[model samples]
Every structure is written in structure tokens, then in C-alpha cells.
Target: MPDGAPADTVTQLRRDLAAAYRLIAHFGMDDGIYTHISARLPDGPGGEKRFLLNPYGLRFDEVTAANLVTVDETGAVVDDPYGAGVNAAGFTIHSAVHMARHDAVCVLHTHTVAGVAVSSIKEGLLPLNQWSAQFFNRIAFHDYEGIALNLEERERIVADLGEKQVMLLRNHGTLLLGRSVAEAVKLALNLERSCKAQVAALGMGQTPIVLPDDVAEHTAGQYQKMYDKMEGAGGKDPEWDAFLRMLETAAPGYKG
Candidate 1:
């Protein structure tokens, strides 16, 4: 098994994850303490299937680097020493995505006002603009089944998501799964923007001209390619990694 990287590299990852928490909170993506965002740790030699997740009952705004729970696939706290625990719903939701979609190393779930508003709408998000067009033909819808605490829900959840990276949980919120932290965050950002656009457009009392299937497929293709390009270009991810640095300045002790 690879001994992983140096302590400095590991520390930077914690900060990046923390920064993501703050960024999501800044964007109002966090619904009190209801939703969750998680990242799968790199699976190297000697590594158990592990992940970093928000501590159970911690508000997003209150999250700290030290507080993030490191757990195995079964939601067991294998390495959390700072007393923070993983959110069970986060496990129930993210574990299914990770298992079914090997490419989804990150999963972001949000219950923002606009997202829920659009999800509750009969037509979910429509192709009202370029931003909304990003999800054009790439969105899935899952009906709400109360809080996601039941382990039995995993099968149905993955089935609902099938081959889609974006899902609109009716009466719940939206979820974005991706191959990396940045990709997942970008998807969530766009998904929120799409939901906001949908709610606002509907509120304007104007009929939305949904895009043609061909156009939607093309747009989704463009987006998928853009991510591929970013991956292929070999750029550094310190920006996200540096987020933890900011959190240390703002809210430390999550590392404790």
C-alpha cells in the first residue's frame, strides 16, 4: 500500500475540504444542517474504502477541518479522532452513489431555497438560458421518501440516478456527483443557478421555451467535454486545497 503523501499534502486536503464547506455556506447552499457534501479519499495500497464527510449535527457554517469524519464504506468511523462523526443520511446517500458510479468521487447535496422551489415545481428545471442548458438533458428526478436515514433506500436511490450525475430530489433538494471535488462543486453551483433561474422565470409569468433534445444533448456534451479538457490539461487544485487555510483563519478547531 502506498503510504500516501507527506503530512503537508494531507493537511492541505483537509483545508481544501473545509474551504469548500465555507464556500457552500457562503452561497447559501447549506440548509441549516440538513444536507451534506462528501469526498472519497484516494484508494491506494493499504487504504480501506474511506471518505471525508460532515460531522453529524454540525451546521455547515460551523464545520472545521478537524471535525470532518473519516469513515469506511459502511459508515464506520475508522479514523476520526476529533470527536466529529459522519452524518448517517450523508452515508446513506453518498455511499450508494459511490458504489454505483465509480467515477463519482464527490457528492454534493443541497436544500437551498431555489433548488427546492424548482424541485417542487412540476417541470423541474427547464432550458431557459445557457446556464440552465448545462443540465439540459443530463438531469434526473427522485421523489422524496422522508429523511434519508433508512439503509434500504440505497438500492432505489441508485436506480433513480441510473447514469446521471445530477439529480433533483422532489420536495427535497438537488444532488451533484462528479469524479472530483471541483467537478462536483461546479456541477452543484450550476445546478443551483439552474434552479434559481427556473423559479425566477416561472415567477415572471412567462412560458419557458424548453430547448430541443438535440440542443440539450449538445450542451450536455459540451459541458462533459469541458470537464474532460480541464482534467486533461493538468492544472493544480491548491485553490481548493487553500480553502482550509482560510478556514483556519476563520474557524479553526475542526482540526482538533
Candidate 2:
């Protein structure tokens, strides 16, 4: 085998991860050159651990299958053909979840306006809407400790996010983890929608209607069951195909 990933696996992972970046940009979830989404790479021929991430300094919309960089678990660029650098400073959070959560094959972090706004609120995300209800009693929160640059922060982050699908960084943004890129993207979209709806509701001055505990728990369970079904045999993800088509039309050659 070559020094890098097997061509077929690399090809599929690249397309899947690049599509996620484009979808994030398309839906206005990107924060310019900030934020990151990473996919775990199988151990290399030499038993080196690595992951795929966007090249540092590129806008999410500019990412393509070929431009994504491969980096070691420590955030060091390993075999990126373009010689692009890694975002070690920002990757602290990503590496933490990827290493701690074995099921987190794909990790996405975003700094969208709505997410940040909701994070600053004392109550965090509320079950004020169907979208928010899905996260009821299931989300985690981590206090903002300045920027996530230090490696020591990794332990704290992993401890805070234990077994949760989504995490809200206090006074910061949101983080989502999934077994695949498609699942993470879908969760990201829902979380952003939840935050946006909460922001809108809070501005109205009138008290927002919160679902009863039983109803919220029931709705959350239903949402989880739906996700499980989508991951089953003969089932399909609802957002992956739609976003792929969007990229095909607007960002042609994204898979290249």
C-alpha cells in the first residue's frame, strides 16, 4: 500500500467530508475561516494515527475533496499533497472528542451567530420547539475556557461531553458528533435551527411555550428512533442526497 490512505477509502471519505463543509457554508453555519469538521482515518501502513480536516486558512466553501488535509492525532500535517498546514490550535476540541468517543467518527464544530447567541444565555438550549425538544435532556455544556488551544483542555472537554451527541460551549458555539459525516451534518442543521428558533422566541418578550416534561421526553425518543431507522438497512439519510445535489449544482467539481 502507499504511504497515505487507500485510494478508494480516501476518495469516499474526501467526498463525504468535503460535502459536509460545503453544506455548512451553504446553510450559513460557517464562521469564515474558523471552526472545523474532522473525520477519523484508519491507522496508516506504519500504524500512524491520522484524521482528515480542511486545510488551514481556506473558507469552508472553497474546500474540495482534494484539498482536505490529513493530520496526525496531534494535529500535525502528515500527508496532505497540497502541503497545507493544520489548525492545531482549534483542533484541540476535535481531537478530544475523536479520541474519547469511539463512536464519533465525524466531529463538527461551528460558530454560527444563532448558536453563539443561545450559548450566551444562562438557560442554554430550551425545549421551546420540536427541533429543541429532540435535544431535551440529552445535550451537554462545557464552560468556555478562553480559546481551545491547550492540550490539557482536551481532558476537560471529553469529561464534559461524555456520551452526549451535541454540546453547547458556554459563551461560544456548538459541537456535534456522529458515527458518520452525514449524521453529524444532520445534527448540526437541527441544532442550528433549534438555536435560531430560541433566539427568535426570546426576542418576542412574551413567554415562550415550553413542552411538558413527558411530551418532550417522548418527542426526543421518537427523534432518536427515527435516526436509528435512517441508519438501518435499506434506509437512507434525508439530508445527504439533498446536500450532494446542492453541491453538484452550485459548487461543481466539489468531489474532485
Candidate 3:
């Protein structure tokens, strides 16, 4: 385990969450020091809910396992060796899902250009291709309600999210929920790519060929079945493993 952290599950959670930040930056999905990717930590000995959040002022590329902040459900920093404060907006959004959706171990929010562009569209994410079809009928939408800083907005956010794994904060950006940090990263990557494709296709000024409803739903089912198989087999995600290997070379020191 990294220094200054308990030698237990939290250690691994920190590394995985930090790796996610690094990977998001490496893939150009990060928006400077804005946006947030959070992972719920195991309850403390006293059973208080806690989460791992990137420090508010640090760029995703600068986040390391040892520097990530640990906060309670109320957004107060419980552990901050570096004294890096958590973002209020991050707490508002992440806490909403974490409190309501016990299955969402990791919640990733992004403000990528493609994601924002797609979020502004009326149709939301169109099933323009295989990448886009993966979320067909599976994604949710929450209308933008200014910046997510008010605690009262949490209820509506959860209501809009329902049980969906992916959501587009209309006029804002994208939100993804995963059973683990790895799963969250995979979802964010695919979602970003899907948005990019949609933006490009729509910009071509030609009528885009959208997949039939049946075909789109069938494709989504295939993707979900594969994911369910992986989860049932003990959550060993191959794509996440591959990304960790890439990180070993591409953006080392996230585990520091």
C-alpha cells in the first residue's frame, strides 16, 4: 500500500481512483481541474459512509494515490494529508448517487467538448453506430439545473438517474456509474468516444443513418450480457487490466 494510507481495501481504492484520474487526463477526457471522478470507500469502523475524491485544485494528471482526499457523506474531509480541499460541486453530484445508489461504487462526471456538445442536442445520444448503440435505451438524462452546488438538488438528480448506469446532464455533460473504478473508467471512455462519433456524424451535414430500434436494443443487450458475465465471474475486467498496463508506461506514478 502507498504511504500514509491504511493497508487495506482503501489503499487499492485510492490507487484505482487515482489511476482513473490519470487515464481520464491521458485520454483527453479531463477538463483541466474541473469535473470529478469519485469512488465510494468502505464504511469506517464506526460505519460512517466515506468516499475518495480528487483534490479540488489539482489537475487530474497531478493526482496521486497518496494525495487523494477522503470525505464523509456530508462532504467534510476526513483524511487529507496534503490538505487539498474537495470540490463542493463534486460532493453535491457524487454524494447524491452514492447515497441513493448502493451499486454505484464509482461515479464519473466529465465535461469533455464532445460530451457537452451531445448533451446540448435535443435527441441526446443517437444510436448512430455500434459504439453509440451500446447505451441505447440504457442511458438516462437529467436536465441541467445550473451548477450542481446546492444540496437540495441531490434529490432531483437521483430521481432523474433512477437505476441507469449512464446519464447525460442535459446542457451540462455526462455522468456514469459503475460497480467499480475500472468499470467506471470503461464506461466513461466508451461514452466519450460515442459522443465524439455523434458530433462528427452530425457535423457532416448529410443525413446520418441511425440503427433500427430493434437492432440498437439487441446490440445493447449483447453488451450488457458480456458485462454481466464479467461481473458474475468476480469482476475481473480485461479492458481495465489493459488500461492499467498502459498506465504503467503512459502515466506512471498514479500509484504513488
**What does candidate 3 score on TM?**
0.95
Per-model C-alpha lDDT, please?
0.77, 0.88, 0.90
How do these models rank on lDDT, best leading?
3, 2, 1
Those runs of model 3 whose alpha carbons end farther than 4 Å from true positions after fitting are 1-6
Runs of candidate 1 with Cα error greater than 4 angstroms are 1-9, 44-47, 236-256
Tens digits of lDDT, candidate 2, 5-102: 57797688789999999999999999889999999888777887678898888999989889899888888888776566877888899988887887
Report the lDDT tens digits of candidate 1 across residue range 1-256.
Answer: 0146576756655655666677788677888877778777766467567778888777887776677878777788877755756666567888888767877767888889998889897888888777888888688888989988888888898999999889999998888987666778778888888888778777898777788878877887897887777655475555445654665676665454
Q: What is the C-alpha lDDT profile of model 3 across 80-187, one tens digit per residue? A: 867869886678989999999999889999999999999998999999999999999998999988988889999999999999999999999999998888888888
Q: How far in Å is the alpha carbon of 187 misplaced in model 1?
A: 0.8
Q: Estimate each model's TM-score.
A: 0.85, 0.95, 0.95
Error of 2 at 20 (Å): 0.6
Best by TM-score: 3
Between candidates 2 and 3, the lDDT winner: 3
Best model per lDDT: 3
Question: Model 2 residue 122 lDDT?
Answer: 88
Error of 3 at 2 (Å): 21
**Alpha-carbon RMSD, each predicted model:** 3.2, 2.3, 2.8
